[model samples]
Target: MSVMQGDGRLKSQRFRQAREGDWKRLERLMDKAEKGSARRLSDEEILAIPVLYRSTLSALSVARETSLDRALIGYLETLCARAYFFVYGSRSTLMGKLGAFFRRDWPMAVRALWRETFASGLLMLGGAIAAAVLVGQEPDWFYAFVPAEMASGRDPAASTETLRATLAGEDTSAGLSAFATFLFTHNARIAILAFALGFALCIPTGLLVLYNGATLGAFVTLFASRGLGVEVGGWLLIHGVTELFAVILAGAGGLRIGWAIAFPGDRDRLDAAADAGRTAATVIAGVVVMLFVAGLLEGFGRQLIESTPIRYAVAGTSALIWGLYFYGPRRRPAHV
Candidate 1:
C-alpha cells in the first residue's frame, strides 16, 4: 500500500478509538488539532444536566463513554455559576430580592407591623389609662407616672397656655431643630440596640419596644386630658408618625431574630436567625431612610406651621399618606 493511504487509515482508526474514550488516541488528536480548537456550548446544552445528587454521576458517565466532552461539562458549570449569581450575587440578585420583597413580602411585613403595634403598644395604652384613672382617684398617685422634673412641665391647668406658648414661640425653629436632631439620633440608637439585643433572644428586645410605646402613650394621654390634645397631637403627628413607625419596624426585626431562635421553622436556630436578619436588615434600611425624612420635617416644618388648623391639616395628611404606603398593596403577585 502507498504511504499516504496507510496514514489515512491510521487517522481513521485513531478517530474511532477517541470516540470510545481511548485517552491516548484522544490526546493525539488534541495535539494534532490547530490552536484554539475548543468549541463553545449553548446555554440550553449546559442546562440539560439535571441538577440533582446524581448530576455528578451522570456527567461522569458521559465523560467516560463519550471521549470526555469537556465543552458540555464546562457549559454545565457556567450555568450553575449563573444560577448562583442570580440567587446570591450582590447587585442583580439583591435587586431582584428587594423587588420580590416589596411585591410579595410587603404584606407579611405589614402584618407583622400591625401585630406588633397593637398587641404590644395597646397594653401600654391600657396601663397608662389605668394609671391616669388611679391618679384621678388618688391625687398623690400622679407622681408615679410623672418624674419630678417632668411634672413641672405637666400642669393640668397649663395645657391651653402651654399650647399657646408653643404655638407663639416656645418651640421656635432653632429649638425645634435642636430637639428634633437629638430625638432622631437618640431614637435611632435605641432602635439599633433593640434589634441587636435580639441576638441574646427575642423577648428582651420586645419588652424594650413595648415599654417605650407605653411611656409614649402615658405621656401623651396626660397631655391630652389636660386639654393640650390638639396642640400636642399636632406636634407629634408632624414627625411622630414616621418615628413611631420606625420603632415598630425595629421591634418587628427583633421579633424576627427571636422567632428564629425560639421557633427556627425548618432550619437550625443559627441559620434561621441569619435568614431572618437579612430580611430584617432590609426592613431597617427602609426605616432608616424614613427616619431621616422625619427628622427633616420635624426640624424644619414643625416650627413653620403656627396655626393649629394648618398644623392639623399637615399632620392629618402626613398620617394618611404613611398609612396608605406601608399597609397598601404588595408590589407583586401575592402568590410569590
Candidate 2:
C-alpha cells in the first residue's frame, strides 16, 4: 500500500509537470479575459478557450480517479466550473428567456403530450355527452348531476322567462370583483387538485375532469328544456372557452405524470416522473394564467354583454388565438 501510494504520487506530479505549460497559458489568457472583457481576447485566444477546456476536463477526470493531491484537484475543479458557465450556460436576459419559453418550449411540450391530451379530451367529452343525453331523456337526472350551489337557481324548474332573466338582470349576480376572485379561487383549487392527485395513477384526475364536464352538460340540458339553449350557450361560451381549455390542459398534465410513472420504459420510475413533471408543470402554470383571463371575462364581459352574437364573437376569437398559439406552424426549433 505504501509503494502504491508513492507510485500514484509520482504519476500525479509527472502529469502536472508535463501539462503545466498549457495550464499556465490557459490561466494567463483567462485572467486577462476576466480582468476586462472576454471580447477583448483575440479570435485566436477565443478559439483556444474550448480546446483548453476539453484538456482541462480530461485532467479533472484523471485527477478524480487517481486521487491526486487535494490542492491540484481543487484548482482543476474551480477552473472547469468557470469555463463551463461560458461554454454551456444560457446568456439570455430573463425576459428573453420568458418570451422564448411561451413561444417555443411550452408549445413543443404540449405537442409532445398529444396522446395524453387526446385521452383527457375524450374522457371529458364522453362525460359531457353521457350526461346531456341522460338528462335530455329524463329531466330528473339534472338534479343528480349538478350541485345546487353551482346551479344558482338555474335548473330544470326555471321557466323560459326566469332563465332569460339571468341575461337581463344586471345587478342580481355578485359584484364583478368579488365574482372574479371567487371564480379564480374555486377553479384554481380544482385545477391544482386534478394535477396533484395524478400520482394515484390518474383515477382522481379522471373523476375530477369527468365531473367538470357533467356540470356543464347538466346546465345546458336544463336550459335547453326551457327553450333558452342559445342564450345560455352564449352566456357560458364567453368565459368557458378559456376556462374549460385551461381545465383540460390541467387534466392533461396529470395524465402525463401518471403515464410516465406507469410506463417508464428505459428510465427508472423517479427519473421518468421528474422529466414529465417539468414539462407538465409548465403547462399547468400557463393554465393558471388562462383561468385569470377567464375570471375577468366571466365577471366583467359575460355579465355586461347580453348580445348573443357579440358573445359568440368573443368566445370564437379567444379559441382562434389559443389554437394558433398552441397548434400553428412554428419555426424550426434551435438546440437548447
TM-scores, in order shown? 0.61, 0.77
- Candidate 1, superposed: residue stretches over 4 Å from native: 1-114, 127-131, 134-164, 167-174, 331-336
66-156 in candidate 2: lDDT tens per residue?
Answer: 8898989999988888777766767677999889888888888778777878887887888888899999999889988888877778787
Off by over 4 Å in 2: 1-80, 168-174, 265-267
Error of 1 at 45 (Å): 20
Candidate 2: C-alpha lDDT: 0.85
Give the clash count for model 2. Answer: 0
Best by lDDT: 2
Candidate that scores best on TM-score: 2
| Tens digit per residue, CA lDDT, model 1, 241-323 | 77777777777777777768888877887898888888777677777767787787666777676666776787678778777
| TM-score computed on alpha carbons, candidate 1 | 0.61
Worst 10 residues of 2 by lDDT: 167-176
